[model samples]
Target: MSWADKPNGNDMARRAGASRSDFDGDFAALRQRGRHLIAEIVRLSRQLTDLQQAIGSRRGAPGRGSVSGGEPR
Candidate 1:
């Protein structure tokens, strides 16, 4: 029939001997890992933003060209 119906029929055929409890446990574990990864990404993004701002401010400060204060060689 249609493409969508093919996959559904295939899934039904595959699940005939599969254990439901095992599938449920695997799904739950995957969901937990996904959430942990998202939190880590947010933390790293904030740290990167803070570091960029610090670098920009340092570069914009006055007397940045003066190393030891004798007109920079």
Candidate 2:
């Protein structure tokens, strides 16, 4: 393209600034979403750990009879 077809320096600067603003906005939104997902993961992990512990308590402690092999001698 001819030089005249190219944007002037001021126009180019404005466009660059706008593009940078868009990127910054997008990154901010992404970071917020990441934080939300991390919180959700932590909450779910805690719930699962609580459930596992509850189930384990109901099953009683492991004993020789609970082993995979036949009854202990």
Candidate 3:
């Protein structure tokens, strides 16, 4: 019930630092996960661009495949 029963400053700081280290490690892991997600986003964007380009390259003339045989109605 006296001052001796209460933890000292050094003990409190050490405990705080121990918990702080766990938080720091968690932050580091989250940061790495964010980096991986960003990289995946960039890769997906590149894939989308490539798909758009491929589609554009494969398109035929406007009236080529029409059922009307490209003739005027």
Best by lDDT: 2
Q: lDDT of all the models against the reference?
A: 0.62, 0.62, 0.62
lDDT string for model 3 (23-47, tens) is 5875686688789989999999888
Candidate 2 local distance difference test against the native: 0.62
Q: Residue 25 CA error for candidate 2 (Å)?
A: 0.4
lDDT agreement of model 1 with the native: 0.62
Ranking by TM-score: 2, 3, 1
Model 2 C-alpha lDDT per residue in residues 1-73, reported as the tens digit of each score: 6334645646766666676676587568668878998999999988876766555555663432222334334
Steric clash pairs (candidate 1): none
Question: Which candidate gets the maximum TM-score versus the true structure?
Answer: 2
Candidate 3 ranges beyond 4 A from true positions: 1-18, 60-73
